[model samples]
Target: MATAGKAVVAQQQTNLPFAYRQYSAAELKEALRKMYLIRRFEEGAEDAYMRGLIHGTMHLSIGQEASAVGICMPLSEDDQITSTHRGHGHCIAKGADVKRMFAEFFGKTTGYCKGRGGSMHIADVAKGNLGANGIVAGGIPIAVGAALSAKKLRTGKVVVSFFGDGANNEGAFHEALNMASIWSLPVVFVCENNGYGMSTSIERSTAVRSVADRAAAYGMPGVVVDGNNFSAVAEASQAALARARRGEGPTLIESKTYRYRGHSKSDRNRYRTKEEIEDWMTNRDPIALFEAELVELGIIDQAGIEAVREAVRKEIVEGIEFAKESPMPDMADRERYVYTEAA
Candidate 1:
């Protein structure tokens, strides 16, 4: 690794376009572990996809790990989170088992959805992950419904709805936000604004300058944070979640982030330039940024960082092997879940 002072000076001199909070050493290290786990898990999934071991289309949250980890930091195991198509990181950060996640990707019986839902539909209700939605804004309403339930039941549980910038244009987003605001539902609408909603850039498709601006219309607090910065994201989420828990109502948090991979495996680079992607990856990699900060802050040396990386790598490899060795679903039960089981 480069010298600690060099990293600190370079980062300090560089002007960050948005506001972010500083992190404690312990918090930084924990965040790094989670972020690294997400990265390695995503990489494993990509490798499996490329090798033809996984079927069906998948969306990898390769560059958006920080957003997932940071947002979930303030959440409880009992607090629900609804996820979009690119939601593996959300599940991982929320304490979903990586072995089961790999099994889901590989379509094994031990998968979260029993191999039925695959990558885009994995869910663990007990872990507070409602599920990942294939539709752009499908999870929004579900999260709202969960928040409503929590309020009615007086469970003191908050719901975090994770969606992409593209989902903002959907009618579901509007309806859910409006309803949540009026009811003062315990929900946080987190928009991972990765610049583009698939092929259409935010500039071309959206009327508002920022997604956070849309919160004013719904009569709630809207915050725009540096999604690549874990500290910034965590602080923003903490505030938003606090408001939700206090019954202050929903919050719209727009996390400005970037997706390193194409929208999916099928997407080409026709919509955006290689230079733009390269710039984001080189300058704003969440993992790299956090690593440097940890070094600069004297939280962890490069060796300690490497140890975390190696551990995460080992876990991912073990998960993949476990998924491969897991059994396939019994063919006789194919007709079972299609109908509701009798009590």
Candidate 2:
């Protein structure tokens, strides 16, 4: 393994006009562990909710781990990020405390918002998480504001706005993009294209076949890659982030991906075909492909992969225990964190 402070080596062989460093064995193993943790955590959340242990609507990012993990791995402690309702994966990827996250879902006082915000509204500002928004495109403007603050303060810190393809049409998306371009603010817009906006397919709703192609209209670079491909996602994200860091403005990345589940807990998903879903699951499986590449490249063996799974499982167990032991928020403080507190 490399020195503790050293950056991980990465492999990205895209035809784009940029190159991303490759990850070493240790780094790859660590990332895989984190990804597995996200997968397991969300699965557990789903199970608990189905068993009536959870309240409120649940938005699961079950099959969308690669985009969040790949893009977030490059962020620094001082950088900021804004996410959507499907944001648990994003929060986890950006290093949010898993225990606090579990507590937030359980409406416990130990959560990021002291249990006030619950699942969709969780965040830890000290860790650069600006919080997740329930409204479509709601977090877009907030992220732009964060980038504006970074520019005005000359902090040299970046902001990542994680949204879905559905958010592209919202006014905040365009307005924020225009502002970011005009000032050359530091931000990366990631569109997790999961093929549908609720029940509508991208083809029916999106005029542009590729969301990244829209970046040219804003006078920035546009790039598209297999969202399921972690290496591809990492490489593209690194390039966009580099440009942002250089004060070159925001870049739009459309991650071509799919979700194996419905939009939310309330969804029936009658609009999509089971055949289509299975195609992505079977053929376009992102994690499975990445594992294959790692093996072919001689980066890890089966034992190392198993070790990653076991480590992720252990961390999740601890997180669950922490959440279980946490105290719920006082019912009297229900209205807290909704607005400014009284003096």
Candidate 3:
């Protein structure tokens, strides 16, 4: 696989959208479908949030769909992942039920966490997703713990930890990496460096030029991938996952991506310029790039793309309706799952 910088240059030079030669036409179609689903789902969630249907603020993964789908596609259902606050795409890509996710957003009793986890705390233990964390780097230690469990039990499964560049600066990130490395745990630390942490640009907060550089200190391969390119992310993830399953230890993958939305609903995006956002939105959109690739490669036509879009739109509509129809948790049941009872 090419280095991150090289991959970017290669994509630009070749004017090719993606390097998905290994994917069959049907698989590519499904990948595009999932990306579209994530896009539409996040858009629908934001609309619900604005209309007061969603109870709390949500961090949308509008532009980083490829980073989520590409990484998860290579793994089996038994493998696990820990997600970040901006993790709706991760959950969806890992096979989350959109209706239930919408229910969770609506704070209904039928939702994940029985509607208690809200946007950031969603988890599907049966899906092998530990949870989406609210605190920065909070899930890293949890992922390491899961990896330790897998190692001790000899489950032969790998755990992936997804965090942002900002989380790399946290104490939990360091501690977890150290312990995982020493114990040769089956985990992959994926850092989604989306140019900024909250409102502050990475250049202002991070001392190193690349987050992957830090992986060398832990004695594992550190790879950087063009996060917008699905093929790049998949290739890097496949390597890291192989290493983890082989009992070699953890690997750190830095997917260099960007989020189109402000850090959250409250952010006015005063830190970045409209030009920069436009550049990424118009030119480097992961969905647009992959769509163009699929069309150009004769894998999918305009009609195919429209079919996928229409289907995704209908799915989002049904999901929202499901959330609207679902019942909210009753007052008596409020404390049921909040804490451990006397059993």
For TM-score, the strongest prediction is: 3
Q: Report how far off residue 59 is in candidate 2 (Å).
A: 1.0
Number of clashes recorded per candidate: 0, 6, 0
Worst 10 residues of 2 by lDDT: 11-20
Q: Which residue segments of model 3 deviate by more than 4 Å? A: 1-19, 339-343
- TM-score of each candidate structure, all chains considered together: 0.93, 0.93, 0.93
Question: What overall lDDT goes with each candidate model?
Answer: 0.89, 0.83, 0.89
Q: Which sections of candidate 1 miss by over 4 Å?
A: 1-24
For model 2, the stretches where C-alpha displacement exceeds 4 angstroms are: 1-20, 338-343
* Residue 328 in model 2: lDDT: 82
Cα RMSD for candidate 2?
2.9
Evaluated against the true structure, the overall lDDT of model 1 is 0.89
Candidate 1: minimum summed lDDT over ten consecutive residues — where?
1-10
